[model samples]
Target: MQVKIEKLDHFGRGITYVNQKICFVAKALPNEIVKIKVTKETKKYIEAEIEEWVTISSYRIPEVCPYAKICGGCDLEHLEYKKENEWKREKVKELLAKFSQIEKVEVKEIKYLSPYHYRNKVTLHGAKNRVGYYQPKSKNLVPIDTCLLLNQKINELLPKMKRLARENKVQEIMIRTSNDEKESLIKISGDKPKSLIDMKDITGIFFQEEQLQGKEEIISTIGKYQYYLSIESFFQVNQELTEMLYEEVLNEVKKVKPKKVLDLYCGTGTIGIYISSEAEEVIGIDSCSSSIKNANHNKKLNQVKNIQFINNKVENVIDQFQQDTDLIIVDPPRKGLDKKTLRHIIRIAPKYLIYISCDPVTLARDLKELKETYQTKIVTPFNMFPRTYHVECVSVLVHN
Candidate 1:
């Protein structure tokens, strides 16, 4: 069926009404008439895939990546980068207004990092005689020679790493390359040979089972901060741009002059410690025990106090909060905060909520919920992960 797409949904899907119900069609752009195959039928909406663009939009362009449509790694490669950012801003605005009922959110210009060669790390799976990312909407893996999103040094090393993994009879391997360039980590999982431990070209860690089980450190650095990152720990990928991103988030905190701050999903206490001096006390909570231990070690290493790192789920820690939190900084995973945590945040009702998210769709939906009792004062997106459709947005919500 031919339909005129009216707008881009949060997932970059084109939304058009059919029978008074929304239809989400992939690979269709706004103002474009496209021939679509209805892959799904549901009570409220239909899911479709674009068979052909009957009339292409002006914004449509040739995607650079060969696997653009199938890789599922990026959805906005066909659209202009500028327009993508604009759509992201609009998505945030729409969510805040529609979901949160907060009006007039001042979304700042999206800060773009290096569009290419910005990624320092990538997780490549091993199965069916090759290693690559999983295909879109399927567990089927796509064999990749190299990704343009990674640094040249990392890309240059993919083949070698793959070879090393195969040679060691490894099923899954995660390569960690850093901005330092001098050091990199190769984590081999699934019955890795001990000979890999003596490899001179790479610093290796072995895992018998899951990716995170046996691996030790994932060394990473941002600005002057050098982190002996735990294998399962969270750290920003784009090194050069992370400083800029953190500065913008800190900029929001500085303006607020928060006394007691609650840092949710505080991976290794990066943001909490970075802005520790400004706030009188900062409490950081995360589910990862390794990350919390590192956060505590980092606190001692930096000789900074007044920042408490707790190894507990945010939901559990929320109940223990002193109810005197002036600012709440929440940086959730791509899935975003669960309903229970969202409810808890509303109950706490801190003066300011500095929300950082890598997924715009979730960020928008969460902001909508927060807008019930809070006003979205500012929304700023940082291009932490460039050369791809992924974006990291920061929203500041203040109590009404």
Candidate 2:
């Protein structure tokens, strides 16, 4: 029952071995001896939930949230902020070394942003029995007063929003509040559209938008540049760190002064348009037709002519990639880049490759394959989703 946690995993769970079998222990800290209840057991490893801390580690601190264990919103709330940064830094290093085997890749340091209230979007689900996020790995929903990671406005609006949501006929209602808290829209997707007239507190526009669809451009600004983001377009959720992320990517892209730049998986052409001024010409590629349309609208809104938005898969447009491309920036979803797309980028062999990833495991795996043709110059980790296991990382690679 008593086990010593050895290290932290990608999902922020502690790793320990019981009888030579690895066990993923949740709510336990490294170098801590704790009693745990076996939740799952397999041939290779076991899964456990901490029962009690027989001997607490020095690194352990009282969690800020009373719902730390029950609520699935945060993973590292129990650990100290400084220690969290150290563990995250080690996480990226281990993933890169283990998956990519890139010997000399220098991960500068894991930058720490404000851990609390860093998230811009919180997607709350409404089930038949309850209304909240699903428990860790189970479908059981744990109702809560507020999620600490969400912005102050969203946290304040949860109860009213929940009441309004219950009045609606739809089972799942997703509320997305923009960074500025200017455009607070709720999408009641699904076949059922019910009247929300009973709720008196709920304000702002109701999108009534379809799932995986886009609408008219919504104006958003980061630093000096203003962007038009479609309701369905994918953008970084953290506002405080958005400018920092774009600056880091822009710094890397401008280092090469690329004549031609490619933005793959470009959603609404936010990044392409933001960095278009640095390059002679920029091209953005995406599979979403609506996203491409929004990207074009964004370009026109910004009055930028150098960046071109194309509606196509990254791999499909690989053939159209000019050999003279000097820089390529990719901001892929959590699944990371596919093998076909990664191979295409390698084949193109741009002078510089900038990859912005939200998942470390996939990023590590892709970096391994890319190291054969490119060398990493810097690996910068940004805290996009704080109070959670998710992290956004930027890796700049130069053609070898």
Candidate 3:
């Protein structure tokens, strides 16, 4: 069936109407006319693949990765980088208007860095002597030797890592590279591979609960601060944009000049410590014990005296700091904020609320709840993950 792509969905799939039903076509761009073969059909929508292109979009570009079509890593590889950023900003605006009831929201221009080689970490699945990501939403693995989004150091070690995976029957391998791209850490689900010890760039190798080689953690330097990251610590994957995102947060904090700041879901205390000088006191909270351990170490490493790390869930300990904190910064996971946490935040009602969210859908939902007590006029989107559908946003809410 010939279809003219109307617009792109939140997941970067092109959308068109088929028999008045929404049809989604992968790799099809807006204003492009393509003949598609319907792969699946349901009552609500249709899924299709392009069979032939009648008109190609000017925004489409040749994919840089050889396995772009097969590997599910980079979905927007065919779209121009400039258009990709624009679509992300629009996505955030669209979500806010649809879900948050904020019709006239101002979204600042997206902040981005190099479109490629920005990811500081990658997790590859291994099965039957092959290592790569699963195909889209399927369990079938697409074998790949290199991914364009990975740091150069991790890409260089892929061959040996592939061999190690095949030899040791490892099911999963996660490699993290420091911000400087000089140090790397490898974590595998199988037994410790002794050969990984000799790799010069690999500063740490972890298997299960044991550290098989080198140090227990790797250091990532961002601006003037150096963060010690463990295998289990939850740090942002994009190194360059992380600094930019945190700098945005720091700027917002400086404007507030908060007396006491609460950093919820504060992994490794990066943001709290980054803006420590501007606040009289800062408290960081997270559920992960290893991340809290690293957060304390980072606090001392940076010689930050105003911030304290708490190894507990935000909902469990947020009430204790309600009376003292004037500002709250929450960096929630993809699922967004929990009800209990949101309730606690509303009760606390800080003077300023800074939300750093990776998923726009959930961010909009949470913002709707926050709109009851706070006023938010603008949200800033950051292209933290380029060549992919994911976008990060930083929104500030002020108490009415």
Candidate 4:
């Protein structure tokens, strides 16, 4: 059936009405009329795939990816970068009002550095010696020769890595390059370890069988600070904006002038370490042991004395939070804070709270809970992943 696209949703799907029922059409842009085949249906809405475009929007451009609709790695690449940024910030605003009853939230303009060839990392899934991402919402593999989202260096390594992966039995291959492009790390997960690949661009080539054991440690630098990344350590996917985001954190924390600070969900202690010197003391807590290990290594590598790293679930160790800790910076995973933990943290009522979130919906939900005891101060969105629906945001809350 043919429908007129109304607007884009948070996930970049075009919203329209068919038979007076809500419909979501993939690969359909706003202000365009398109014919779609119903793919899935529910009482709330029906999902569809665009079969033909009756009228394309003026903003629509040729997609760089041939397997875009099926690969599912990127959802918003079809939309123009300007429109994507506008919609992403608006999505955050809309979710805040709908889920959290927050209105007119002042979200800063979305910051986007590069729209293409910006990603510094790529993870390819391997099955039966073929490599690519799984088909959308399915386990089926889709082979690809190139991806416009990955860094040029990663793109250059794709064909060679594919050949190497085909020769070995593996589950997933992760390739990462440092922000400076002077170093790269390739980690292949499989049933058995194999000979490492020696390429000029790659600094560390490690195989993960039962555990992560590698030759050279993966080190990266952001501004004045340097970070050590292990095979399992979590780091920001976008390198350039990481520096920008950290600069934002530094600016905000410097204003608070925290004597004692707590960095909750501090993966690899990047944020804590970045602002450690500004504060008299900094404590970083994360659930991942590998990340905490790297965080401490980073602390020692940088020879900073004011910061400490702990490997434990934040909720389990949150009671140890010092009452005098003036500021708490939280960079949690997508699920956001659990109910019990959110309540506990809010009850503590730190003088200032900084939240770093990749998922806006969860962030809005947590903000709603925090609003009762804290006043929403600042919210800024960063384009961590361009050409994708994913967006990163930093929000600050002050005690009421």
Residue-level lDDT tens digits of model 3 in 289-381: 999999999999999999998999887887675456799999989999999888888888888999999999999999998887888856999
Best by TM-score: 3
lDDT of 4 by residue, 107-143 (tens): 8898878887878788899888878899878989998
The pairs that clash in candidate 2 are 100-368
Pairs of residues at least 3 apart in sequence or in different chains that clash in candidate 4 = none
* Better structure of 2 and 4 per TM-score: 4
Model 3 stretches with alpha carbons more than 4 Å out: 191-197
What lDDT, from 0 to 1, does candidate 1 have?
0.77
What's the TM for model 3?
0.98
| lDDT winner, 3 or 4 | 3
What is the overall TM-score of model 2 with all chains considered together?
Answer: 0.92
Q: What is the TM-score of each predicted model, taking all chains together?
A: 0.85, 0.92, 0.98, 0.95
lDDT of 2 by residue, 301-364 (tens): 8899898988988877787665788898998888999888888888788989999998888998
State the TM-score for model 4: 0.95
Candidate 4, 336: how far from true, in Å?
A: 0.4
lDDT of candidate 1 at residue 285, scale 0 to 100: 93
Pairs clashing within candidate 1: 100-368
- RMSD of each candidate relative to the true structure: 3.3, 2.6, 1.2, 1.8
